[model samples]
Structure formats: structure tokens, C-alpha cells
Target: MTLKYALPVIALVASAAVSAEEYQAFVGLNADHYRASGDSETNWKLDGTYFFDKKVTLGPLDQFEYINKVTNVSASFRREFDTNITRIGGEYFAENGLVVSAAHTRASGDYVNEVGLGYLVSNNFIVRVNAVKPEDESTDFMFSASYNHQLQGNDYVGFTAYADDEFDYFGISSKYFASLGEGRFIAAGITLDDNDGSSDWSAEADYYFSKMTSVGLTYNKADSYSLNAKHFFSQNWAVEARFASNTDDSTLKTYSLGVTGQF
Candidate 1:
């Protein structure tokens, strides 16, 4: 499957709306262009999410979202090579702090399944275990944990850790979000991943000029980086653009554009 970087952009847009009321539904359309080794390809993706409860919000730079009891359904579709890659998933967050999620994905005529169980240990901490199975592979188990604490108002710091049984992979990351007052905010994060005996590092930073506009940059140890920006025309609609290039290979690049809607 093609690597999809859209989720980070989506999260950035959602975080920019920290002071605004949360939306009950979201839809996004994105186009990606890739050029590598003198070959180029383009693909399109459509994705959406619907919240079952109106009270659930990405509160305080999205750090306190675990406190909200909500259920949500999400799905996405991508077209490449005249074939479709599709996924559908749903999550239920119970009032008692239990969380359940399941998803199914189909790509290249093969299916993959995933299920997870989680618990909100507290308003600021959560843990989860997941199992995944591919059409021709054994099931793999993964574990993850996250903790976030509010510093002040909309400012917060968070840490996360993850491990998977299949690849002997382990990773840890940390992020800090600062609300600069007057609709401005800045956030940064660093991640370190270890698979078998190999290691990789990545970092990202973002700045929100206002509740409706933001820009971000991301870098990987593998000599690749991306810059992206997003702006909302109104409370319910937005547009985004991104450019990425690999430092080791000047000819390898990617360009993307996206449109998003909230209601």
C-alpha cells in the first residue's frame, strides 16, 4: 500500500480549532502526486468521520479528548493502479472508560482485519492492545499507551509508546503544545523507532497563525521532509497544500492538495 500522510494534516487542522466548538462530522478529499526514480504516479483519496455524540471534542489542543464519551465511525477510499483500497472502522468509547474498535481494509484484492481494546486509566492517560491479521499472514499483537497533561489553558504535553510482536518493533514519542493566546499556537514532537536492530528518527513542528490557518514541517532521518499549509475559508470548509522531497534523491518528490469539510 502507498504511504498515506494525510492523517497528520487532518490532525493539524483539527488541533487548530481548539477554541471553537467541535464538529459532528468531517469529510476530506485529497490528491497526491509522487515522483521517484524518474517515474511518477498520482492518486486520489476520500475519507470521512461521523461522531455519535455532540459533546465529544478535541479539547485543549486535543490533549483531553479521552475524557469525552463518544462513538465514531470512519472510512476511507483510495484509487491507484485502477484498483481501490478501502477501509471502514468504528470506535466506541463507553462512559466507564472502556474503548473498543474494529476495522477492515481491502487492498489489492486482499483483506486485513484489526481489532483493539483500550481503557482510559484516567482523564489524561490511556492504554490499548490491538490484534491485526492479514489475508496470508498470522495475527500480530501490538500495544500502545499515551499520557497527556495540561500545562495551562490550551497548553499541554504528551508522551506515547508503542510495540508490536511481529517485527520486534518498539517506538516512543513526545509532543508539546503551547497556546500563544489570541488564536496562535505552536506544537512540536519527536519520535524514535527501533525495528529489530535498525533505528529511525522523525520530528515535526507546526504553527497556527489563527484558529483557521496553520503551517507545518516534518523531517525523517531517512533524508526526507515535507512542508504543508492549511487554511479555512469558513468555519465549515478548508483547503490544504503540501510539498515533500527527499534530500538523498533530488528527483524524488511529492505534491498534494486537499479539501476538507466539517459539520
Candidate 2:
């Protein structure tokens, strides 16, 4: 997608609403090499979170990837109402949009704000729906859901589905944990996407070496593939390298390398 087309969707999503718990703080440098276009770009990223109290937190996040030359940055604030009740929060994306949300627990059942801004929560599943109104354009609604089951210990399976005005996709994924020498486990997933009646699928596999090293490979029905590897030198430091290619059309390829740190 071009910048003009992407910026609006990103802005709309940001205006609507958005998770991983990796590090409390981090910064990184990245290099992206695009073979099909014979172009190389440098990227920088920084992100951090601060706690004001046991129930309140603030976050400043920023990231740069070589996709359409877009950079993402956001400021977020979250407050926990109680341990298993409602947690209210909102985020503002720089020059983008604003999102407000609340998350509840299964014991608390489902909830909807007076303005329709809440999600359904359960012990094993979650569903969220939101609407976005961008200036001078039609409103877009997005919905996503995930279901997870724990077979035993850390072994589990999951299903995810997402839909919006212009996109629809669904995926099923699972991971099995065991001791195979230095390797800990393997994970696999397949995603099907309906892109305006033209459907495509992608498959992915990942192997984890301990908790600090891993490699992943992905292939799409559109004749594109990607490989990425990550290794941590310490609990607080890591490096990642990735390569991607498309065999069709101009035969494009992209490579990236990054070093990261966590507080």
C-alpha cells in the first residue's frame, strides 16, 4: 500500500483503539534492505512504560519499520479499577487518532459503556468491537475475537478471527512444548484472508531454543516467504535478523537487522 492509502487506515485504527508484555523499556536500531526496489533504509525505535501507582501506568511507545516509510508513536494511560473488574484506559497516537477502552474479567461478565466502548470477557475467550469515524470519510467498524484453550501445562491451542469494513481474516494456531535437546518447542499457524473476494493463505512455523533464542519461517500463497531469527545475549539484550522475498513479479526481497535492550 502507498503512504497516502495507508496513513488513513492507520490513523483510523489509532483513532479507534489497540499488546505484548516483553520489556518495561527498550530502544533499538534497525536496517532494512529491500532487494526488489534496491533500496536500503535505517530505522530507530524507543518505547517505555512508567508506573505511577499500583493501579496506574503510562506509556510512550515509538517504532519505525520499512513499511511505506511509516513511523508509529503513541502515548497511553491505563488505570486498573480493581483486580477482576474494569480497567479503563486511552491512548493518543501522534498526528493520528485517539482510542479509549475498558477491559473486564470473566467473573465480571460482559459490559458496554454508555457510549458503547467495552468488550466481552470470559475465562477462555475475548471479543472486542469498535467504531472509527475519520474526517470526511465513512465510519469503519472493526471486530476481533480470540479463543484459547490450555490442553496441559504450557501446551495450548488458539483461534483468532478479525473483520472490518475492508478486510476479513481468520487463523488457527497451536504450540506444543517439550524438551528436544536444546530446543524447547515448535509452533505452527495458518491464516486465511479474504481480500475483496481474492482469498489467500499464509502458514508459519517457529522453533524456540530456550526462552532467549528462536527462529520463524512464513510462507504466503501469494508466492512470498519470510525468515526471521532472534537471539538474546542476556535477559536485557537481544538481536534480530529477518529476510523476506517474493518470487513473483519483480522478484523482490527485504532484509532487516535490529538490536534491542530492555530495562
Clash count (model 1, backbone only) = 0
Query: Residue-wise lDDT of candidate 2 within 1-263, one digit each (tens)?
Result: 99999999888546323211233344555566665565544433333333221111111111111011112222322222332333232322222222234322222444333112323354456565666544345656767666666554334566767777566433333333332443365566788767567778888887776556778898989889989988878766789999888768545877788777655
Which run of 10 residues does model 2 get worst, by summed lDDT? 60-69
Q: Give per-residue CA lDDT, model 1, range 95-195, as digits (tens).
A: 89999999999998899999999998887888999999999999999999999877865577889899997658999999888878766778899999999
Which regions of candidate 1 deviate over 4 angstroms? 1-19, 55-69
Return the clash pairs for model 1, or none.
Answer: none
| Candidate 2 lDDT | 0.51
The Cα local distance difference test for each model comes to 0.83, 0.51
Predicted structure with the largest TM-score when compared to the true one: 1
